[model samples]
Target: MIIFGTALLAVCHLLGIFLGDLLGQALGVKTNVGGVGIAMLLLIFARIYMQRRNMLPKLTELGVEYWGALYIPVVVAMAAQQDMVSALRGGPVALLSAIAAVAVCACVIAVINRTERPQAQTDGAPILHDNPLLTEAE
Candidate 1:
C-alpha cells in the first residue's frame, strides 16, 4: 500500500542519517554532513531499482512521488533557517566561495549546453529547452 512507500522512505532516511554521521566522524566533523541529500539519493535509486524490477506498485509509487515532491520544499525550508547572516559576517571567504560556486555552475551549464545534442521525438514536436531564453521566438 501507500504506507509501504513511506516505510521505504523512512528506512532510506534512517540509513542516510547513520551513514552521514559516520562520514562526519571520519572527516573530523561534529555535524551530520549531507544526511538529507543522501536520503534523497537513496530514495531516487531505490525508486529506480524497484521500477526496473517491476517491484513497485502504482499506488505505492504515487505515495513515494507525493512524499518526494513534498521533500524538496521541506529541505528548502530547513536550509532557509541556516545562519547565513553569521556566515557572511564571519568572513569574506563565504561570499567569495558563493561567487566561485555560482561561476563554476554557470560554466558547467554552458559547456553542457554547447556539447549536448537535441534528440528528435517520434511525434515531431519541438523539444523544449529548460531555459525559456534558449527557446525560439514563436
Candidate 2:
C-alpha cells in the first residue's frame, strides 16, 4: 500500500512538473515557483475535500508525518534568502509599510471570519469556546 501510494505521489509530481513547464512556456514566466505553487494549491484543496468526505486518513496513520517535516528546510531556505532579508532592511518606511499591510490583511480576515461564522443556538447546550481546553472540559 505504501509503495503504491509513493508511486502515485511521484507520478502526480512529475505531471505537475510537466504542466508547470508548459504553463511557464506559454505565459513567458521563468519561475518554477509558480508551477509548484499551483501544484501545492491543488493538493491542499484535494486534501481538504477528501477530509470533508471522511475519506482521508491522518498523516500519522499513513506513516507520512515525516514528509511534513521536510517543509522546514524549504522554510529555512526562504527565510535565509539575502534579497528577501534585504527588502526589510531598506528603510523604516518600507518596514512599516510591510507591517501595515500584514496588519490590514489580518484585520480583514478576522472580520470576514466573524461575519461568516455560523450562529449558535440559544437552547440548553453550552456554547463551545474557541479554546480547546474549554471544549474538553465541556
Candidate 3:
C-alpha cells in the first residue's frame, strides 16, 4: 500500500537519473539534467494513469500525495540553487535557457489571464456607478 507509492517514487527517481545522465552525455555536459523534475513528472503521470484505470488504492494515493507535496518544495529549492550557480558560470547557453524558461512562463501566464478576463467581467455582479443626490429641479 503505502510502500507501493514509495517504491514507485524510487523507480521514477532512478529512471530520471538515468535519463538525466543520458541527456548530459548527449549534450557534452557533465551534470544530471532535470532529474528531479523528470521524476516528479513521472510520478504525476503514473498517478493519473492509475486513477484513470481505477487501480489506485485510496490510502496509497494519499501517501503518494503527501510525499509529492513534501518532495516538490525541497526539490525546487535545490534545483534553483544549483541552476543559479551553473547558469552564472556556464556562459551563454545557460543564460539563454533561463531566459527562455522565463519568457515561456510569462507567455503562459499572460494567455491564462487574457482568457479569464472576459469570463470574469461577465460574472453577473452589478456594476456600481456614482449616484447623484436628488435635486429639486425636475
Candidate 4:
C-alpha cells in the first residue's frame, strides 16, 4: 500500500534530480534546476493519474499526500541554507530575477483570489416556532 506510493515518490524524486542536473548542465549553471519542485509536481500528477485509473489504494494515496504536504517545509528549509549575501552580490540579474518571481507570484495569487466566488452570509440566530401539538383543539 504505502510502499507502492513511497516507491513511486522515490522514483520521481530521483528522476527529477537527474533531469534537473541535465537542465543545469545544458544551461551552464552549477545549481540544481528546480529539482525538488519538479519532483513534487511529478508525484502529484502521477498520484492524480493513478487515482483516475482506480489503481491507487487509499493507503498509498495517504502516503503520497503526507510527503507532498512536507514538500513546502522541506523546500523552505533547503532555501534557507542558500547564501543570500553571495547570491545577491553575484549580479543585478539575480536581484531582478527574484523581483520578477515575486511579482509573478503576486499576480497569480491576485488572479486566483479574484476568480473565487464569495460565500453567502448568514445570521446565527435561531428561529422561533409555535408547537402544532399545543393547539386549543388538542
RMSD of each: 8.0, 7.8, 8.3, 6.4
Query: For model 2, which pairs clash?
Result: none
Task: State the displacement of the C-alpha of residue 93, model 1, in Å, after optimal TM-score superposition.
Answer: 1.0
TM-score of each: 0.74, 0.47, 0.65, 0.70
Q: Is candidate 2 or candidate 3 better by lDDT?
A: 3
> Mind giving the per-residue lDDT tens digits that candidate 1 earns over 1-138?
889889988998999999999989999999998888999999999999999999999999998998888887998677756847766786988778878988999999999999999987686667765767666555
Candidates 1 and 2 compared by lDDT, better number = 1
Name the 10 consecutive residues with the lowest summed lDDT in model 1. 129-138
Candidate numbers, best TM-score first, in rank order: 1, 4, 3, 2
Candidate 4 structure lDDT: 0.85
Candidate 2 residues 35-79, lDDT tens each? Answer: 545544444555567569876566522522233234346644774
lDDT of 4 by residue, 1-138 (tens): 778877888998998898889889999999789888788889989999999999998999998888778766887777856847766777988888888989999999999999999998778546476767655555
Query: What's the lDDT for candidate 2?
Result: 0.59
Better of 1 and 3 by TM-score: 1
Encode model 3's per-residue lDDT on 85-136: one tens digit a residue: 8788899999888899999999999999888745445666564754454233
Q: Could you tell which candidate, 2 or 4, scores higher by TM-score?
A: 4
Off by over 4 Å in 1: 122-138
TM-score of 1: 0.74
User: Each candidate's lDDT (Cα)?
Assistant: 0.88, 0.59, 0.85, 0.85
Give the best candidate by TM-score. Answer: 1
